[model samples]
Target: MRRPTHLRLLAACAAVAFACSAFAQQPPIERQMSPEQFKAAGLDKLTPGELVQLNAWLNRTVEEETAKAASEAKRKVVNENRGFITFGSNEPIVGRIAGEFRGFGKGRSYTLENGQVWEQVDEARLAGVRKSNPAVRITPSVMGNVWYLAVEGSNTHAKVRRTK
Candidate 1:
């Protein structure tokens, strides 16, 4: 009985080994060169050394083009974000008030000298009467589209949002 069991285990191990070796697939190449591609490029007739050179050039070209495409894509994202009127986190704006300042008591809107219109979103008000065309700054906080607006030198600020 023991001899028969040992023979069965050996047979199972041999079958597994045979299956693994016979069904093993080739590793994928970084760049594929199919038979049709080889024929199209007339690479099928190239000498071994010349074929090696062609593959090297193709790999380099693919790498450079991939890197260039990635860079352009990143630039496009940044430009698209910049074109919008919205302010991103950490970005700040400084400009003169377009008209006489009334004061933000219960959320008011004001047009800056630069033509940007902003509205206060909170109940924070100014202490003193802001004169005509006072320079103001609106800066984004740690996160979110929420911005804080105040006079150039005043500590008082209000949570505001862009209207136009």
Candidate 2:
């Protein structure tokens, strides 16, 4: 009788192990819930076909929402850093230079009021010029990463690179 009882215990343990493995292979919706919660939600009474359909709908919804969120995040980042980062937009970045503007010189950095910093990359100069808080327009090239920074009320345009 004791031997029969021990055999029954071993069989019950094996059955539990098999059930756990099967549960591990189920969808996230089913795997995430405890047995009590599944029964309480009446999901335990769902047929296998119903469970599959529910999991499929959940997966599609999650993927679509995730994609939308990722796209919105990317758009926000690009909009906020339009001056410093390029996102294939042809619109020129227009802003005022913070503090005094001593004109453009090679290797000089210009800090914009929007907190973007650009360095003059080419040998462009505007001699005998001084202004305070002058507006600037930084235009991108039509087919490349090259950008030109032009000061307001002047024809002088300097080739520039984002430094910060």
Candidate 3:
């Protein structure tokens, strides 16, 4: 469901970066404006050195603002995907199951407090146990996309995949 939104955000960031590079070769504000418009704006009176300084300032400002926007976009994406295993993160996802957590069973779905839903995919069970909002640690396999969900304080783990 969220894959489209992530793609769009990534595309928008790429577009912004491309646009910045397109303007990189022509950073002079005077060139972007017509000669008549420049004179009308009273920029014609500025000395050559003053024009160079102005262009430099404009470039710096654009770079700074673009960097800030990119940083903010990245933060939003990371926050929105708190429960899922993101790229470059090797740590396990730690959170409590949302409600009554029965012992793990194949095909059972578990919802986490961080709004992630995971479903058991393999035959791993912990029978005759129940807990309310139990803390869980979902860790990714060292070599594959496989992830395991383990209730805190237990040695048993269930193979799972994110469903939401």
Error (Å) of candidate 3 at residue 19 is 5.5
- Report clash pairs, candidate 1: none
Pairs of colliding residues, candidate 2: none
Q: Residues 36-104, candidate 1: write the lDDT tens digits.
A: 875787767878888777767765665666556555654444332321223353557778888888677
- Residues 48-74 of candidate 2 have per-residue lDDT tens digits of 999989998877776666556556655
Number of the predicted model whose TM-score against the real structure is largest:
3
What global local distance difference test value does model 1 have? 0.64
Model 2 TM:
0.62
Ranking by TM-score: 3, 2, 1
lDDT of 1 at 12: 51
lDDT value, residue 123 of candidate 2: 96
* Sort order, lDDT high to low: 3, 2, 1
